[model samples]
Target: MNESESHGHIPAPLGSVEPHAPLLSVPSDGQLLYKISSVENLLRSIVGNYLHFNRVDSYADFPGADPHDGRQLPKDQQGNSLARFEKSPDFSAANYYDQSRARTYACCFSLENSDFIWKNYANGSEKGKVGVVFEFGRLRTMLNQTLQPGNAALKYNGNQCDQIFSVNYGIVEYVDWDTHQANVDHLQNPIRYTYLKDKERFSEEKELRISLSAMGIGQFALKDGSMMQFPSSLQLAFDFKAAIADGAIQQILYASDSDSDFLQAELHKLRIVSSKG
Candidate 1:
């Protein structure tokens, strides 16, 4: 909810409220809108589709592998330095052009489920409505190839370049603030981010910050200060059914501010009434 939406609803006075008060919900509001839930859902889908099995070995994970040597040593069949580190999963295809496979890092941004950053942004409490907070300790760097074109779709063939983690959905699903509805358009600039060679610059300092600009298109700056614009398209299909069927879903949550004890209380009340009869 935006500040406008938040301000529209004020909590009722204590005297006017009841423990089991029935609340009304907007079952069908036609106005096009977007919420933090959309982000959560999309992220969950990304994790299921790719993040869960990102097997690219980190230098730190390799015994005695110098962190500074991460840039070299790993080479593909051609002996050319690998563009990126990825696990060669037989089931997952690497480059769409070659029909080959390799390890691809599944980079993601995590905000603990309980974090109330969304609430602050919604209520206009965040100054820029732009800066974000990322836990560096939980950070993961992605393939440099992806940074070139965040949009993985092949320009001429309509093929998603990397089947393993390439996003298949189009821009039609993104929320367009101008129309205040969902809009679809090809990405002129694919949303992309790149981590600096010195990953420890921020972690050594023990600080993480996310930057956002929300007026027109929301842009999020990665911890490495790489800018990944909020996609003008929605690649994660909003179809929860398909997502679940394909195992592209991690968790589902339906949350509300209503009393958590309402259901149990109602059942108990019914039992008492029946006993009297």
Candidate 2:
């Protein structure tokens, strides 16, 4: 089936807006998103027909990434207040803000197919790099269908815990945190932070983020001698072979002519074809 036939019908893209509008907005279904990575990673994803999300905290090595990317506490619990809580006798700040327990796994993509993205993400590797193009609507459809509702048992501080799984995708918002304030309620909805980035990254990366979040309902003690139920983290992967069959993937841009030949052969071996072809 064709693109429109696959997604039912395409919607108009959400145009540019002021900072901190709704955190999630859908682009035009026909819009192409690019994922640049090492050829090995691309090949693995293609051959396995799966997308893998690394724990959000493990992105410390990414350029211009915040050191505390996935570890931010709620607004009321930040800065000087956090210092005071750290010294509190009744409050165990570590347990209360146990980022490890509330895990977020993410895979990133770019709306722009620029040289900057190519150099930063796909360059400087002996193995070379490649960019995979995905159609927005089909990808969204695949992710929605692939989303599985399940429960997980977790252990934190020797206590048994349970978490529920959820998935989200959207355009990443670039913010000048020095000036722009995020209107999100981090205490109740921390997963929204996954779609935020510093303005320094705005020019280079127009990002689209897909995140899988697993949060538990365990209660933790606050510095005020009160308890609040918070989310614990989990990680997961999803198979997209069916979406591929429906033409979610648009094209593969290889680093070289030789790489193109290699990909054509590899894709042929996997029995994959672009909808355009």
Global fold similarity of model 2 (TM-score): 0.67
Q: Relative to the unseen true structure, what is the C-alpha lDDT of residue 170 in candidate 2, on a scale of 0 to 100?
A: 75
Give the clashing residue pairs of candidate 1, or none: 86-103, 86-104, 87-103, 130-212, 132-210, 171-233, 172-184
TM-score per candidate, chains pooled: 0.21, 0.67
Segments of candidate 1 deviating more than 4 angstroms: 1-35, 38-111, 121-239, 258-277
RMSD of 1: 24.0
Q: What are the per-residue Cα lDDT tens digits for candidate 1 across 176-268?
A: 212221112311111111111233322221111111111111122333445432221223223333333433333333234322244234434
Error of 1 at 182 (Å): 37
lDDT string for model 2 (1-277, tens) is: 0122112222212211112225576578888999988776667776665676766766666565555455443442443123323233333333333442255667788998988777777555556788878898888776665453333333344564333335677787776645544433323245556666666755478888777654322334334445433332232344546656676877777766226566667767877654453
Clashes (candidate 2)? 5
